[model samples]
Target: MTEPGQGQEPERAGSRAERLRNWWRPEGTWRRGIVLAVLAVLLGIVMLLHSRIPNDVGNLGSLLETFLPWFGLCLPLLLIAAVLRRSATALIALVLPVFAWVSLFAGQITDKAGAGGNLTVISHNVDADNPDPAGTSRDIVASGADVVALEELTSAALPKYRDGLAKAYPYHTVQGTVGLWSKHPMSDPQPVDIKLGWTRAMRAVVTYHGQPFAVYVAHLPSVRVKLDAGFTANQRDASAKALGETIAADPAKKVFLLGDLNGTMNDRSLAPVTSQMRSAQGAAGDGFGFSWPASFPMARIDHIMVKGVEPVKAWVLQPTGSDHRPVAASVKL
Candidate 1:
C-alpha cells in the first residue's frame, strides 16, 4: 500500500477508532453487554482502591468498602452478558475483573475452621426495643461463649437481662446501655467516658484460667447519613476516639473489646479503635460475616477485637430477635 500523508494518517486513525467504538457497541450485539463489561472492571478497581476515594461525601470510601466484597458478584454477570452477546472485546475485558476480584478477595474466600481455641468471645447489639430481652439473653448464653458483651441494654430490659444471664454467667456487670457477662471471675467494672453524657461504654477485668485481662464493652452513639448531611454522627466519632484512648492507655497485658461500634472496620471514623487492635472476624472468619440488619446482615457493626491474643476462629451467629446478629471468635490466650 502507498504511504499516507501525515495529515491523512491522523484522519484515518480517527476513523478506525470510531469504527472500533461502533463495533464495541454495535446494534447487532447487545449494547448493554459492552457497557456491563467495562462497569464490572471498574467495580474491581473501585473495590481494590476504595481507600483512595474522598470521604467528604458522607464518608463515601467506607460506605463502598463496607460492601466491597459484594462487588465481585457483578463479574459473573458481566461474563455471562459478554458470552450471550458474543462480543470479543467485552469478553476480553472480563479478564480484568476476574483477576481483580480474585486478587483483592481470593485470600478471604477460603475457610479456616476446626482450629481449637482457648477462649470464645461473642458480641451482640441487642436492640433496645426488643420485646423479649430475656429470650434474647438466653439465646446468647446458650452459645457457650466464655465472655459475652451486649449493647443497647435499655432500662426496661436490664432486669430481664440480669435474670436471664445470672444462671449461666454468675459474673456480669452493666454500665449504661452496655453489659458484659463472663464464665470466669470479673472485677473492676467501670464506665468508660465516651463523651456521650451517658454511660454507653465500660471496662472490666476478668480472670480467666488464673490470668487476668481487660475487656471493654461499648455502644457508640448512633450515626446517620441524611440527604443533606453526611455521616451525621459527630458524637459517635468522638465516642470512638475516647474509647480508643482508653484502649491505648490500658495497662493490662491483654485486652479484648467487644460491642456495637455503630461503624465498620472499613470506616475511617473508627480508625482509632481499628488501628490499635485486630478484628477477630478479619483474622479468622470464613466470610465477611456481616452482623447488622439481622434480617439480612448487610454490614458488620458488632465486633470482637483483641490485643495480645491470637484468634483461631471467628463467625457470625444467627439472629436472636435482635436487630443485629451475634459475632463470636475463638482466641488463643
Candidate 2:
C-alpha cells in the first residue's frame, strides 16, 4: 500500500492541469480584455500614422507629435492590465504597439555619438527674466563652444551677458533679441523678419578655418494650451514658415540654425524648416537632447540643426539660471 496522501497526488496534479487549460480557453482569455486589446491596437495605429492626423482642428496633430515619445508609457500600463485580466488577446495585441514604437524610435534610443568634430556649437534661450544673466553667461563659457547662439535676451540682461562673454568670445553681434558669439570672426549680422513686427531672429556669417558659414538665430513665438483656445501656436507656426523661406534663400553652402523654436522636430508645422536641415541631436546624440525648462527638461525646443555639414556629436549642457537648458553639438565644417 502507498502512503496515506501519495495516492491523491496524481489527482491534484490532473486538476491543476485542467485549470490551466480552462484559463487559456477562448471563453476565458479572448472574451476578457477586449477593451484593452482595442486600445492597444489603436495606439499602434496612431503612432504609425501620426503624420496623417489632421492639424487643422486645434492643431491637434502637431500637439500630439510634440510629445510623441511619451506615448510609450502606455504600453507597460496596458501590459499590467492584460496580465491582471488574464487576457491572451490583449497580450498579443500589445505586440502591435511594441513593434510600432520600436520601428519609429529604436535607432534614437541607441548610442550614436562618435569621437571627433571640427567645430563645436551651442545654443540657448536664456530666459528674458533670468535672475542671473551673468552666471548663465559663465556657464556657457565653460562649455568651450566655438560658436554660441542665444535667444530671449532682454534689454536689462543684455549688459550682463555682454560683459561676461566679452573676453572669451571677442567676435559677437546682437541683432534685436537674438545674438551670436564666436571665437572666430563674424560679419553681416542683421535681423530677420519673421512677420512678428519685431526682431526675434537674426543671421550672421561666421568664418571658421578661413571659410564662412551662415548662422541663424531665432526665437519663435511661444505656444500655449488654454482650455478654450486649445494649442495656441498660430503665431509660432507662421513664424516658422517665414523662417524656412529665409533659410532657403540663403546662398551659403553651409548653414546652422540655432534657437528656441517652441516646437519639436516631429511637429509637422515645422516641416518647412526641418525638411531642409538635419538635427544634430537626432543624428549624433545618445538620447533625447531635451533642452527646455532647465529644472526638468521635457522637450527639445532649443535646437542645433545643420545643412551641408556632418554632425559628430550632440548633447544638452548643465542647467543655469535661465529657465531653458543649453544645447550643444560638434560638427564637421
Candidate 3:
C-alpha cells in the first residue's frame, strides 16, 4: 500500500502539469483574430489619410498619394475574414476606420456634379519630343475651347504647332516652352519666369466674349527617380510655390491656370495653388481621367484650374503625338 504523503505528492505534480498545459494552449483564438482584424482596419484608415495629404516638396508626396486608395481595399477583406471567423467584436471595431475614410472622401464624391458654365478652356503638355505636334495642335483646335494652353513647346517644333494652330487660334503668344492660343483677342502677353533660368511659364489676358480674363500657362519642372531617394520632386514643388505667389498677386478676379504640374490634384504639396484655385476636372470630370505617359494613362498630371469661373464639363482627350493626353473643360464667368 502507498503511504498517504507519497500519494499527495503525485497528485500535486499532476495538477501543476495540467495547469501549465492549459496556459500554453491557445486561449480564445477568436480574440487573437479580432486583434489582427482591428489592426488591418486601422492600417487602412492611415492610408486613406496619407493619400489626401498634398505634395509639399514634389514627387515624394505624389508617390505616397498614388498608392493611398489601395488601402481601402484592405479593410473589406479584413471585415470578410472577421465575419467568417464570427468575431463580432472585431467586425464592429472596423466601423471606426470605415467611417473615417468615408468622411474624408465624401466631399470629393459629392463635389463631382459641378455647376454649369459658359466658357471652355483646354490644357495639354504636348510633350517636347511629340512625334505629331501638328496632329496634337489640330486636336486642341478641334476642342473648341475659347482658350488653349500648351506646355513643353520645343523651339524646333514651335513653328509646326503655330502653323497648325493659327487657323483656329487667331491670337497667340509663346514664352519659352509654354504658350497660349486663343480664339478671342489676347493682350499683355508676357513670360512668367517661373524658373529662374528657363522661361517655361507665361501669362496673358484674353478678351473672351468681350470680357478680359487672366490666363496662365505653366510647365513645372519634371521629377526624376532615384534609388536612394525614390523621387526627386523638389524643383517641381518649388515651381508650384512660386506660381502660387504669382497667382495671388494677380489683380484679376477671374483667372485660369493650365499646365502639366508634374503632380496630381490629390497631392498636398500643391496646396499653395490647389487651395487658391479649383480643378476643372475635379469639378466636372466623370472619371479619374489619367493623362500621363500616354501609352497607359494611370494618373492625371495635366490640369486646368479656374478661379471666379464656373466649370461645367471636363474630360481627357485621346492621345496624339505626345506622351500625355490633353485635358479640356468648359466654364462660365
TM-scores of the candidates in the order shown: 0.87, 0.93, 0.81
lDDT of 3: 0.80
lDDT of 2 by residue, 51-156 (tens): 9999787888999899988899999999999999988889999999999899888888877898779899999999988999999999999999999999999899
Candidate 1, 1-333: lDDT as tens digits = 656574787899998877667764556343546676677668767866778998777767766766677788887788787787776667777787778778867866777654779899999898988988888988988899999999998888899989999988999999888899999999999999999888999999999989999999988988776788765767888899999998999999899999998888877779999999998888898887788899988778889999999899999998897989999999998
Error of 2 at 234 (Å): 1.1
Highest lDDT scorer: 2
Query: Model 1, stretches more than 4 Å misplaced?
Result: 1-34
Better model by lDDT: candidate 1 vs candidate 2:
2
Which consecutive 10 residues in model 2 have the weakest lDDT in total?
23-32
- Model 1 has an lDDT value of 0.85
lDDT of 2: 0.92
Index of the highest-TM-score prediction: 2
TM-score of decoy 2: 0.93
Model 2: CA > 4 A from native: 1-27
Q: What C-alpha lDDT values do all the predictions have?
A: 0.85, 0.92, 0.80
Off by over 4 Å in 3: 1-29, 32-39, 48-62, 73-90, 93-97, 106-116
Flag clash pairs in model 1: none
